[model samples]
Target: MDEIVTFGGRVTLGQDRQADDTERFLEMVGDRVRAARNRRSISRKTLSEISGVSQRYLAQLESGTGNISILLLRRVAEALDHKIEWLVGEEDPYTSDAVAMMSLYRQATGEQRMRVLEILDPDNPHLRRSRRLAFIGLRGAGKSTIGRLAADRLKLPFLELNEEIEQASGMPVNEVIALYGQEGYRRLEKQSVERIAATYDSIVLAVAGGIVSEPETFNYLLRHYHTIWLKARPEEHMGRVRAQGDERPMAGNPAAMDELRNILMSREALYARAEAQIDTSGRGLPETLDAVLDLIEKRGFLRA
Candidate 1:
């Protein structure tokens, strides 16, 4: 009884663990497959049609008798938009909200998750953010210049998120993106935000315009910082970039201006979510700086 004897009468190490548990494993797989299908509202016949597996075989598999092949199981998993590991793993996906919540969260858009967070945690944002302020807008919105000037005048610490990213990464922002790709860079950026939130209580921060395109990061900024949208006309944006000698925006692309306009139009709503806005469309450096400082003071953004 201690040793397992095969057909050739060759005894092997105790019982084959997998062999002895085959029935349990098969039952578990069947239960998972059925639960996944039911959760997705797909009948066995429909799943069979989608998975290209025979209905009889699927019925046997679900009844916990058929030893389904890996390839066929993979097909069923794909048909259910699930991973093969999830189907075969010991953990019951439906037993815990954490697993189900993560799946739902991963499938949801950034705006949807943001709204859900707002509903789930309706704490006072002003108090949560403390005295931190963030300036968000396109590249030429004068965020760095105005933010620095305002921070100097207000005697508050000023930090550029890109600079922080570069410092933490030991490389430039472009190099970080090149080395880690956009998704990796985004992860690093989120980490930087968390670090800043935990580090300094009062500071002026400038962030990239594309930050709004990322819903979760933007939502974090909204919750933890007094955000200001520094907007400018499309032409002004281009001109300012050109003035800074950064011809990258319109270097060789003839439709660069149009592209810039399209980007602005697309992100307008996201940027508009800021607590306040300042249009530096036609304003000079001094005027824009004054406007930003005035808005911050008038809005009492730094009030604790």
Candidate 2:
């Protein structure tokens, strides 16, 4: 008979539960290792050689009796060309398409991975937005200038989303913002995106920098059109806008540059979700335009 000790009537039970949970987790890890090896048609001896873990240890591991160290498990995972988390994850790697897709996505080239993402996106299911390219960035990334140039060179229609919104509302963007408020403006923005998707199959589009702040609308844009993020330093962004005679960004705000940098930092991850990116910092307008065009052509962004 074994003596059980309890502290406050809970310790013994808690210990039992924790032990059982740990045993189950170890069994799961063992099962995954065995399954992965079997799927690859690798023998225990061969796995041992590849992973540098002894055959006896591999046997014990597969039998759920070996409490392998994390470093050793990592080596085995690498030998199997699988992520360690896949083996230890709650989802069964053998059955989960998500795990498989993640593995494939990790192994895929940038272009192929983007295609996989596009196909898997649940947001928009109608075929690819044919021959449509969108340039997205902050105010001074040269979206309008580069976008128009690329469109003309590619012989496609060029449309700026803000202009479309103004045309649709029959008012300037400032008036729309002033009268309807930010939320109202966002509603109009979403509608304009839908209209453009329906209207054009071959066009270069430029959109407001803040579009990425709205997840649904941004996801829709990503689903429909091939997107490119144009990047620039905060100073360059302010300088370019000022060069265009729009002093609103720095007119009275002493901290405008800091705010701009903060905005870029915060939205950096969201902007990176684009399929392609172009950094225009320190580049001449023509050089940036050529780079964007080259990327589009190289990536076959407009190909149906």
Candidate 3:
């Protein structure tokens, strides 16, 4: 239309001012659309073909000059394997616009969609605080510290599963795994989780990183507790574990780096099944705690 895009308070444009607002909005939208498209490796031509929004207009849309209807925007997002809300640049914060876009792209193309769906759209009997909430992620993920801090902040009792495991088995996790095998240790884990689930109230649980190995146990925990996967890059995980004077993680496993990365990859689907995920990457303890607080607040729960 060779007209400048502008956002108008009116439903229809008033020639000059409308053109200006629409143009600004269009530019912003186009910038976002292009970035999203590039991140997904989606070509402009393919989006045009699927959305039927035309290459010229698409280019203009990307340039912040074209203003199309939401209907057409939906098609464009769909073609890009995104949601209509993705174009809106906001969400309830549990699903930010950028995260939604990345998640949608990852889901459409990645193999982790099933697990992602379980977390993104879970089956819950109640929306209230879970009695057996668990935090499952790598060590040095601030589980004990964060779990304790969150418990203190919420005035809830916090229990470390590993401490329980060691007390129950009278052995370290590695020794337990070695002597009893993964299955035997998992039996203990299942029992521990089930016991907690069957008992307790207002918990901020800290689950073992390997807990996901037992899908049944993990799923059972999910049915009860609001799980949060404290996420971080591999380097950060190793540093945290080491900082805690836990060198066993690096022992014997000569390929510890690759192994940890691969382990994360393998269990990512399982970890992603939690009620919520907090990215502790490059974030301090306060920031991380604040994020957890924010998540809890947004979930519509009163702090313990």
Candidate 4:
């Protein structure tokens, strides 16, 4: 058969098919970008500001009339707090119910999806199954100290969630955040928690303070772990950070303490959702450790 002249020049059937496939892929990407932005209620202007891409270009991309570089598209995906693979229709290795919910939300239309979201509780009781004990709290809440001591006394392995995240990403937490932003960091955090849950039968995990900010990840933690909130005052948190030679907590912020207080206040309710609480405020290290040990014994978390 003779090749057809699809354009000004003669083109093979294979070439025409390839061109069609490329166009279809671009259109799919555009649709996904628009859907994700809509799901997040993010305007083009907001995405442009966060992604450093021009608003005009974003509009064009969404409309499937613009050609975008992979790097630029990655910036947009990161800004939307979505993985580029998800946006581009690639399978995620770490798929879960929560991840599926996120995908469904992105792919659904308005109003009905909002109602669906409202009905789906991230912390539903059906999801709860205690396998390990996890300590949650503000930055200086003695999660590391108390958790480690309790784990040692009980003959359980102790792991810090932040350290795990750093290990998984092969970089410091600060670097992960710098390279991938908070959204990227949270994604890694969720994956790390999942990996830990599957790898360890019984362990003591000290979760990141801001893990609560991501509902799906936090809910997963709550479901798979016997969670305990380790509470401490804002002053103690600041003091501990300072003692560790991390002055960034108080650097260049006159209202740092106030900000810390506000964060604790905002997250109080979330922290309280833990199965147990240990208030470490104004207590010595030994006393705090004792309290944690006692709480674990009393609550029967070791066998949980």
Candidate 5:
């Protein structure tokens, strides 16, 4: 004999079809809540005690014989560490960030945030085009410039790994080394490269000139993606670097120029692991780009 007020008007439970629909919806919600409780291995008595709803009332709701107030639903959901919408057979709201690419989702009301997550919960995450492009040479090489341009050409993202590590640590690269020491910087650099590699697909990586110091990361790149070695003459490198006033590479050594040459000579084996080598001596942007493109085609990266 109880009357339920619906959107259209007052409805008596036995006489109104719309009231029947509401009853069906309520039954479904109660069934869902019972299932959730069972999934967590909670019995009705435990749930009733913990939620402070009487065991008989809780049983009536589970058996589709009792009405649930909004307040009761809220209390039950909170006791279960979930949202009331979840207990009421509505979608979970915690998954909104997964579908940030949706235009309407971006503009949706704050209340719709949970609804968005429920929508995207069943799909795969987005893919990213990222890669690693290491510039191998002594100081003054065109790694940053050429790497950026190549990234632009391929329509891929770019990063100076050294700069990323420095920014992430909030200190200069040398200062990090001076403070945390050499092994610490290498650890940071390795973690950064691995994290980027796993997250992105097409990227131009600009590694430090000394990344060959860690052979593990070097070998991993060679095994996984196309590696490009940007090479130039020692004199050309020194000229380019000195023009930019980066004197650290040349300081405290009488034969710093020869030392650079010797350094390249020592790492030549590692550099040779690159899929393609570009000798940047006297080569401007166009010629160097053409050379790289030709190599990319030859390596079967881009088909005819």
Candidate 6:
């Protein structure tokens, strides 16, 4: 004797449940296929011509009455410029925006992918109004000088990121670097930024010049702060470093100028991703400050 199942006092057979599940699956597949076709503005006749599937078969598929083989479904998916998994509801529905994002993601390198993920991450802090403004650029690009002055004028707190890192580790940055190496420094850098982002609502941050080299940390900063790239000519960078009484720019490395140029060249693209930029070359501190203030005003970054 076959056992019968009762739901709500109604007897149900196992075959009945299997049949219902199959029907639901078919309906879901049909709905997704129709949606994908409509989103592309593709007609069944056009799809049939491209995919070599019959118009009648496509119509049946959309109506949830036809069974489709994997081979035929692949052909239809290719014609609609969608993945098979997307058409079959195995993945999220494909919108034009999602399609474009996926295409860009596929083409991005690992570091670039980290930056992209920051933008796409749902929990990104900067998705809301960011309270911090970060200045990014090579050393001697006026990030410290201009960022501090901007913070004063804006009546916000100013923080140098390296100092923050040192404080967090209870050691100077150079010592931290010497003990932990570059990878360890980057890990600490990320932790420090996370802490600062959580603690401050409105602040000005001066970041290290090589921060961009660590994509994960840099991406987090991009998402949590209003970033501005402080730009300067290579000669100006060296001269300004020297002016600050820091001979480290030329100390121990005779090819320091060439090295500086190479570093700038490599980081130009990453820095350009900042929300805004100010060229500090040939500009006085007051003039540069005014430029940054003007940008802030224009962007409505400061909350009333």
lDDT (CA) for every model shown? 0.89, 0.90, 0.78, 0.85, 0.73, 0.86
What is candidate 1's lDDT per residue for 1-304, written digit by digit as tens?
5676588896755466657698889988998899899999989999999999999999988889999999999999999998998889766776867778878988988657656666777686766687899999998999999999989999999999999999999999999999999998898888898789889878999998899988899999999999999999999999988999999988789999999999999999999999999999878989988888888889888753
User: Which predicted model would earn the best lDDT?
Assistant: 2
- lDDT tens digits, residue span 1-304, model 6: 2346567564556667788988877777788888888888988899999999999999989988888999999998899887887766544645557766777888888657656756778575554435689999999999999999999988899999999999999999999989999888999999988889899868899999999999899888888889999999999999999999999879999999999999999999999999889898999888999999999999866632
Residue-wise C-alpha lDDT for candidate 4, range 1-304, written one tens digit per residue: 3477666988688877887887878777888888888988988899899999999999889888778999999999999888888767654313456667776787878645545644775454422443488999999888888889888898989999999999898999999999999999999999999999898868899998999989999998888888999998899999998998899988999999999999999999999999899888899999989888888888767632
Write one digit per residue (lDDT tens) for candidate 5, span 190-215.
88878777866556777887777688
Q: Poorest 10 consecutive residues of model 4 by lDDT?
A: 122-131
What are the per-residue Cα lDDT tens digits for candidate 2 across 1-304?
A: 2346566453465667888998988898999999999989999999999999999999989888899999999999999988899889888877988877777878888668557657777344334666788899999999999999999999999999999999999999999999999998999999999899999878899999999999999998998889999999999999999999999998889999999999999999999999899999999988998899899889878654
Q: Is candidate 4 or candidate 6 better by lDDT?
A: 6
Which structure is stronger by TM-score: 4 or 6? 6
Model with the higher lDDT, candidate 3 or 4: 4
Separately for all candidates shown, the number of backbone clashes (residues 3 or more apart, or on different chains) is: 0, 0, 11, 0, 9, 0
- Model 3, C-alpha of 257: deviation from truth (Å): 1.2
Clashing pairs in 2: none
RMSD vs true structure, all candidates: 17.8, 9.6, 18.3, 21.8, 19.8, 15.4
Which residues of candidate 1, in runs, are more than 4 Å off?
1-122
What's model 1's lDDT at 299?
88
TM-score, prediction 1? 0.60
Model 5 worst lDDT run, 10 consecutive residues: 122-131
What lDDT would candidate 4 get against the real structure?
Answer: 0.85
